[model samples]
Target: MILSTLDLNPVIDLTDEQFYQLCQANPEVKFERNANGTLVIMSPTGGETGNRNFEIGADFAIWNRQTQLGICFDSSTGFRLPNGAQRSPDIAWIKQSRWQALTPAQRERFPPIAPDFVLELLSPSDTLPASQTKMQEYINNGVQLGWLIERKTRTVQIYRPGKPVETLNNPSQLSGEAILPGFTLDMSLVW
Candidate 1:
């Protein structure tokens, strides 16, 4: 890490509220780290990272078939963890009901709870142990399911409560089973 003193102007510390306004002024800037010490998300753009496996994520949401519900490809939306960590998922399933439960005022604020489901696409530079712990974090915070997609192997690591670890490799099809009934993702699209 490079640390250097600025010679242009005196170093100024901005509060969280002030930093937000600065981001507003400079639309091109993306300030992931904040003064409050939030853990900026470490994930990739689903559109670019896994254009090959998109159908899988799409098929899962399509199986759900609820218009008020949908999947998020970019890790833009974030929810604060109980531990104050703010890790975003590459993809998330936001059910209408759970979301509607929030009042308009509350919706404007960071959600107190995590999404119903999360999917993490593994990049070549990503570490398995870190993603595994993130998967567990979802379950610990009441997430129903978490999918860790391995791009190279074209496999998925499924995480569910009270279930054994499952690694499906080039399966004919992938199903959300009961969690997302009738949702079948044709693996052929991914390969």
Candidate 2:
């Protein structure tokens, strides 16, 4: 929903003023601001596709048990853009400690920063280059790693800090690596 004022194309250009105008137009959107002045926006991404939900659910059921960090979410989670804007990732996770630091009042709504790890499952509506830019936005904002899962190809792009992105097609195990040490993501179950 943070893309409301901007284009979701490869350029990834949007203004905060336009974003607020869109928000004023759409009451369905919900916004949250963190202590650091970061903002998160959550909006219904349109009607859900039942099958994708099943895939995401299955992935979470297995992945959450291995890590102390929060599991995963297809529900909108905000990420601070390089330009101080925010974008809603398809799936996001925060380090348990970072989240624990929040006050109960702050936890009532979504937190206003990027998750430590993020997964953007590419829907038919998303553009690849724009999605890549979205992943970069999280990285710039301190996200340790990101996954750009392409549903059509059944592949994923693994983004790690200070390294080139890794493209995996039909990966067997989605390891947490150092960022999520000992945490294993068995994306094998996703359809």
Candidate 3:
């Protein structure tokens, strides 16, 4: 969905604690913060986007459950990236070792670590440029792999560290590669 940015610069810049508290106070809303502390309020997705997201998330959840090699997180999970931006991808996965390294408190809150893999599914109100920018931000913050899926265009933009993005058109499936071995996403469910 299209995001609305709230600039709380001179008025009152929200500190990390304040942002966390704001999120806590409004449990029904989804929020994200950029490196510059600009608050991004995300709109709720339509039914089609929600269904596709759930299907994709379920695929990742099942893979992670079987592999037990990492932790899978849904859209509700927020992460504090190295760049100091708090983001919540449509789906996220972090290596088991990395997740275990965090303390209980860290795990309980928005974990201060980037996910190894992230996926963003474009909704009707979502813009391709915005999604691409978000994916690049993920890579800059040490995300190993990211996928920006635009269902309307039947395209996938793959992001990786130090590598140019690879676009796939109407692929039958997507492989997890080295990041998520033995995992494959069924495009049928996404379509």
Candidate No. with top TM-score: 3
> Candidate 1 overall Cα lDDT vs. reference?
0.60
The 10-residue segment of model 3 with minimum total lDDT is 1-10
- Quote the lDDT for 45 in model 3: 95
What's the TM for model 3?
0.98
> Mind giving the per-residue lDDT tens digits that candidate 1 earns over 14-83?
4445544654675453333322453233334445466754655566556556643543434555555454
Model 3 bad stretches (over 4 Å): none
Q: Please give the lDDT score for candidate 2.
A: 0.63
Give candidate 3's root-mean-square deviation (CA, Å). 0.8
lDDT of 2 by residue, 1-191 (tens): 33333224354333555545555676676553322334444444444433665566566656676654574655444444444655556667676777778777555444555677777776665568867877786777778988888757878899877989999988877886776667666665554
What TM-score number comes out for model 1? 0.69
List the candidates' TM-scores in order. Answer: 0.69, 0.68, 0.98
The Cα local distance difference test for each model comes to: 0.60, 0.63, 0.93
Runs in model 2 lying further than 4 Å from the true structure: 1-50, 65-67, 79-83
Top candidate when judged by lDDT against the true structure:
3
Q: Could you tally the backbone clashes for each prediction?
A: 0, 0, 0
- How well does candidate 1 match the true structure, expressed as C-alpha RMSD? 5.8
Tens-digit per-residue lDDT, 1-191, candidate 3: 65699889779988778989999999998999999899989999999999999999898998889999999999899999999899999999999999999999999989999999999999998888888999999999999989899999899999999999999999999999999999999999988
lDDT of model 2 at residue 96? Answer: 74
- Model 1: which residue pairs collide? none
